[model samples]
Target: MPLAVVDAQTLVDSVALGAVYALMAVGIGLVFGVLRLVNFAYGQLVMAGAYTLAFTSHFHPAVSIAACFAVVIALSTAIDLAVFRPLRGQSPAVMLVTTFALAFLLQAVARIVDVRDGTIGEPVRVVGRLNRAVDVAGVNVRQVTILAIVLGVVMLGLLALLLGRTTIGLHMRAAAADFRTARLLGVRSDRVIGFAVFLSAVLAALVAVVLTVRRPLVTPAYGLQETIVVLVGVVVGGLDRLWTATLGGFAIGFATGLINGVLPTDKTIFLPTAVFTLVILVLLLRPGGLFAPRGAATVERV
Candidate 1:
């Protein structure tokens, strides 16, 4: 590839990657902001959605996508009702550990079900056509890249409207600000939490769809790395605020892409090391958050 072409492609890929990370960050930030608990199982939810898409790959794309959404949302709601709900009001440490166990449990189940006869990954090609690239301003952009960008913008806008204009959104915001006070003031805890999880699952399914397009081989551990990276980005952006977390996710992803673009292909192995070294540096300099205003009170809120 020409240097210019490579740079353009890198920019497109970075934007798409950042958008997906932002979506995941939004999901994680929402739950954390409300419950003050980081659900480590959130990645497993994405894994489940990927598997759903793999299983339904033989069906019509629309049907398969719908099934993916249904499965993820239902599973998310079920987890809340069965696990998190019962443990509500427990110590944050206990809840966090429960999520860790839940993550392992779900991953193990997926391994058992999908890793048959030593085969571990299933190809999901329902949106395979999206892998093709098209020329845009002399740069080649994958169709799915455009789709990812569009989805990210639309989802973010809708979420903003939901939080700004709707009653449920108001309740969610209130709960994030102060759950106990919100509950005491008539914000239904169950409703708020359920909605947060539901929305989180929806975002996860979307992530799975985009990820499956980029990497069609769905495995039990799919989404785990991305989730971990996004979680780090969320913390780097400032866990106390939602928009900052989203920006943090985007920032890290963009940095990753930029690094990948500049490094020789043979030297790509250093990508993770470079990324994390930068992360450590950022943390050392601004333990609170990279984007957070200096001296800002680190109030925990959604």
Candidate 2:
């Protein structure tokens, strides 16, 4: 294929990647809003969902996707019950380190399960049709790419409604603003955090399904790199507000796609270096966040 053709494909791919990363940013930021914890293990939830999809590939696609959601939500709940709940009042550093430990531990567990079949990875063919491309404006665009963009818009829109129009959303916003004050005013912290975890897990499972279509092989380390990049975006966009964090995620993912497409194929190894350099520049210019308000306070707000 011509390099120009590849670059064009990369352009579309970048948009899809940005949409997916924005979803991830919402997942991560939701937890951060309530718990003030980064939850580095967030990627593990996606990995678990991917593994579920892989293991159940023989089932109908709908069933496999449902199972993925079930497994991820269950794991997320378990983590909240065993880890977050117990470590609730701990310092941010302690909670952060615990999430790191949880991430590695989940990865190790995944590796053990993954190798049981004498292979290091599993293929999820349930949604393989998404890998096929369609002609769009004289260009071949993957179905998954279109699906991702549509899904991103729909999910984000629904989320906006949920947060802005629902009672639980109001409570969550209140809790995010000031947990102590919200609690004093009768907001249930545990309920808010649990709901946040549930929503985050749902997004992770959806991401797993989309990702497995992009890369069907499910490995223990699946979603790890994406999580790291999205985290950078969360910080870049401003951790103080959910919308800004999400925008940051999309921006980084979009930039990454462009950079990768522009670089010589063999020199793609420097993609991270280029991406982080951009991040450094952005941070130096606006340490508060690219999308944050001009005089946004340091306090957290969803």
Candidate 3:
């Protein structure tokens, strides 16, 4: 890799991508922490939000964004109630399969809804202004890229505060640490899990907004690949620890973006191949997780 080829713009964009992945990592990790469920359908929540934004694009930007949030959160809640809550005691493999099924079902439904308007995809016009670039220290940066970084930092900070200072947050932490013991100690399992779903949904909604600002087209598979990549990062970073999982997400995203920048334009199509090869190398070196604590046993969570 030629260091001279990677410019300030690439660095900024990579950080922004990492920030977005970090948010997704936190979302996925939140549910996994409490329920031991990977929630493969998480990207569907983002897809729903993106579709909501597309459908409501004719409305005021505030209303469209608000609708996006409402739709994603509601869909997430519905999935929790209809599927996850019912299978709470099932084996992890069963739950994982359920998520896979739910993901495909949601995608099929999205495709149907999309083609009902005689189109395979919809454009989100509400936030197109975010595509505009602004000069930052002599480097041009997209407004949405800046927003992603800011949102990631703010949300992570807020999450840290919530987990550290609030009662529900403490309850959640306790539940994540040891669900059976926490329940024995009077922690409400349903409430903690429900709250986790809600937080994850919020993050999905935020991710949808940021993603649409970058790619305005809302397709059935809009967030599918990103979710998969983030899952890889979460596991590679150490699913056993939330911070490690988040760091993994950010690291993978940064690496992907950096690699894309370094690769020749014609070879950029091989991006996924290169990224996964790097992932294989990382796992070979640190099977437990790149950010996991030294001497901690590696346990598969999902």
**Top of the candidates by TM-score:** 3
**Could you tell me the TM-score of candidate 1?**
0.92
In the range 172-279, model 3's lDDT, one tens digit per residue, is 999999999999999999999999999999999999999999999999998999999999899889887789999998998897788777677786778778667766
Per-residue lDDT for 198 in model 3? 97
The candidate with the higher TM-score, 1 or 2, is 2
**Candidate 1: misplaced stretches above 4 Å?**
1-6, 265-287, 299-302
RMSD of 1: 3.0
Superposed by TM-score, candidate 2 places the C-alpha of residue 98 at a distance from the truth, in angstroms, of 0.5
What C-alpha lDDT values do all the predictions have? 0.88, 0.91, 0.92
RMSD of 3: 2.0
What tens digits encode model 1's per-residue C-alpha lDDT throughout 78-104?
998999888888887899899989998
Given candidate 2, what's the lDDT at residue 50?
A: 96
Best-first order by lDDT: 3, 2, 1
Name every residue pair that clashes in candidate 2: none
Better of 1 and 3 by lDDT: 3
TM-score of each: 0.92, 0.93, 0.95
Q: What is the lDDT for 279 in model 1?
A: 69
Position 302, candidate 2: lDDT? 46
